[model samples]
Target: MISFIWSPGNPLPAGTGGSENYTVGQVRELTRRGVPAQVVTVGLGTDDGRDDFVDIPFLSLPTLAAVGALDGTVVFVNEPHPVPTRRPAFLILHNPPPIREQHRAFAIEGTRDRALIATSRYAASLWSSYLDVDVSTINVVYPFAEPCFAAQARPDNRTGTTRVLFAGRLSPEKGIYTLLETLHIDVIEQDVALTFTATTAGADKPQGKIIERLLREHPAITVVTTRRTPASMAALMTEHDIVVMPSNSQYWHETFGIVSIEAQHSGCRVIASDDGGLPETDCGGVLLIAPDNAETLAWGIRAAIDSGPLSLSARRYAGMRFTVEQSVDTLLTVFAQPQPSPPATIIRQLEELILAPSVEAAHTVRVPTGTTA
Candidate 1:
């Protein structure tokens, strides 16, 4: 038996982001192959926001201690809580390492003795350097789009006005602000006949409310309800001609843009930033631009409009690229392999060497060249 551990107090979302979708897809695929797998949440009870995914199995434990006591292969998602397990455990690094020194210290401690899995090669390199571990010790398990995305069909005839959708969460890191700023430019507003749309995903957060308000007030952008299912999101993608992902590169680097592949699989062209793992998400229909720049994003949209719709051959290639089966196969291979021992002593020594005199100085401290915060 294998169990994926969701962090305590954090309810599993329906289909709002890549990590949630990846977890669900992994469990479902594992079950289909007769592997007993389940998502174990702590303290969420029945209120876990998994109403949209009733088909997926879930188990609730009273405490994190109980989760650590489970007799199975345990895989911790995102945050690696320090706990003793019956078997060797694994921690999947969904987000990049925290910027704060205290948080990084906790992460370093939690990662000891547990195998590490990153969602992309870029993420693997970033975490390996941050944790002072060998890059080969970290395994990559790329996230996949559901079958519904590849099955979505496009319209036979193209419209004169390009329909662009920002399908990511309403967060600043996802580059919704960049797209909004680009739309306000005189040149783009005057020259392009494009209709913009954004989803309400992630709008529940405090910061998201501010962005959501801006999106609703924008004259050219239409705000729509977030699609809670893969099939619904695929349908939404098929209706649009293009999708934009201007992930912020200054602070938050996109580990991997799942929306990029989904858009391509749905036969829509994608315009994403060039930094981080965004460039790796190309399935033959991605146009990369300078991250966090409105002018560059505007020009990228113009380029996509000029290129016309995605080709039939490109769409076919996308269909074969990132599938649930491929992702699960790679994950199974990693599970079967022996876990590598990361140099925890070296990690502690590096932390001590970099310890700063003040909190302000510590925040500014970063790893050496070829690695990032």
Candidate 2:
């Protein structure tokens, strides 16, 4: 039996976050496949535990210890929680963790029957280099778009004003501030009516005061504060001519741009900063912008506005590559693979530090032919 354990704080189904959505979709798809897969969620609003996925009050050590007693269970942990289980387990690395956090995680989780799974090749390479582990040992499993995120109908871009959208976090790293700066250039908003959807309210409201001031000052930019479901978000994407993700590399490089993929899948021409795993998500469905440069971003946005909605081929490529079916199939293949040896046994060579390139040099973007502006 395969069990997916989410954080004690996260909710299921109605939860708006990426990891939450992935878990919900994975469990549902697995159930449909007749796989003995279940989810262990918390704060689900129901105590009945009537669903195939069980609801626990919290993921305390006691709870995990109790779970350890279960037989024939293979666990997949979404968050960094050490399950005190004898059963084999895999840690899903959705994003890159800070060095201290990684150390703490390794200390608690140990290396036995525990293997790492990264969401992108960039992430796998990052972790492998940071931890001095073999990159090949870490499996790269790309996330999938939910059915609701698919393109229903492409928006006609020849209308009066081109509608441009900025979805996801309002943090500095997410480049909301940078995007705001781009508006200072008159060419950016010429025929474009920009929309900023506050999809995530960042960790402890990063740059809250500045973002608030930006939104208040730019009243012409439509602010969609209404909480959106996957279906609604997809519909919202379809309504827009272009979607921009100007992620900055200075803070945390984007691990994977899930929203970028979903936007493209919904036929919105995506313009993204080629930071970390963002290029992987964009694939053949985006216009690449160099990280942290407002001029380049503004240029990309203007180009996208002029270019109009994504071509039919771009939308089709996104749908085929980032579907739930593909993700689920890849996950099943990972599960079928034999258990990996402990990471502790792997030698960490000091020579790597002298040999490997600098961090900035490592995360540099090289846009592919079809995906570039």
Candidate 3:
């Protein structure tokens, strides 16, 4: 039996975000393989958000403290929490953990037995360096785009206006400000038609209002601020010639750009920032731009428009490389490995990982390189 522990009270696949999509894909793939997969919702009741996955609800986190493990059971946790089970658990880290507070997690005692999994090689390296854990112990499991994002037939580019789409968060960290700057440049040049799909609402209402104002003022730009179903998003992606991902590395090294993969799957060429794991998604199909650079983004956008739609080879590569089956197979292999009990020294370091206040604090107070807290 396999179990996954996600955020408390939230529905499986909490949002259209990469991690949520991955969780739903994992569960569905596991079930397709005849594995008895279950999800432990850490809180009572389900939220409004939902996905089309095989939902299996089990006990919550608060109740796990007194529970005993079942033989042949394996658990995978996607969020930061005190280890919930002794049944050969694996901590699947979707993002970089809080830098300084990591040591406190080690003190939880339960985490000492859980193995680690990172979504990308870059993420694995970053976390291994940060947690003082042996890189060999951390498996790299690349997430696949949902099947809904499969390649679609593109509109004839012979005489059509170039359509560029940006499907992600409307926040500064996502490089939204840089994207806005690019749009301004594009509009002034009158080079290509633009559409911005803000997948999730911004952290603040002010940002949303600013984006609304920008959309209202720009005659050449269209904005999609509502959430769409996976199918709807895939269909929407097909209507565009290029997709933009200008994530800023200063605030957060985008652990993995799932939307970039999805865009490729929809046969859209990608204009991405070379931030964190963004380069890995290139697959010879991306136009790379420096993070937080609006001029370069504008140039890349115009370049993509000049180049025309994505080629068949690039689309095929993305479809074949970033499939749910491939990712699930790799993950299942890692899941089969015997769980290792970390040593006392490493456990001490992990405790620091949980306890450290922040990345800056970890660098200044403990590990000079901020590699290990």
Best by lDDT: 1
Task: Please tell me which predicted candidate would have the highest TM-score against the true structure.
Answer: 1
After superposing candidate 2 on the true structure, give the runs of residues whose Cα lies further than 4 Å from its correct spot: 10-15, 42-62, 71-78, 99-113, 155-159, 189-217, 345-373
lDDT of residue 344 for candidate 1 = 64
lDDT for 281 in candidate 1 is: 92
User: Which model is ahead, 1 or 3, in terms of lDDT?
Assistant: 1
104-179 per-residue lDDT for model 2 (tens digits): 5663344334678888899889877865677898888788777776657765655566677877666676788788
Q: Local error of candidate 2 at 296, Å?
A: 0.8
TM-score of each: 0.91, 0.79, 0.80
> Lowest-scoring 10 consecutive residues by lDDT in candidate 1?
356-365
- Tens-digit lDDT track for model 3 on 1-373? 6767666556554334788777767877888789777666654544424334425334444444433453345555555455455565677877665545765474334335567788888888987777566787778889888787774566565545677776776666778778777766743356544444444434335775676666556665676644445667787788878888999878688778888888898899899998888888875568889899999988888788778777788787777777899998988888777645554436688899999886554444556784866
Q: RMSD of candidate 2 to the true fold?
A: 14.9
Global fold similarity of model 3 (TM-score):
0.80
Q: Write the per-residue lDDT of candidate 1 for residues 166-237, one digit (tens) a residue.
A: 999988889888988999777688865789899999987888889999889888889999998999999999
What lDDT score is found at residue 278 in candidate 2? Answer: 89
Cα lDDT, all candidates: 0.88, 0.68, 0.70
Residue 372 lDDT in model 3? 69
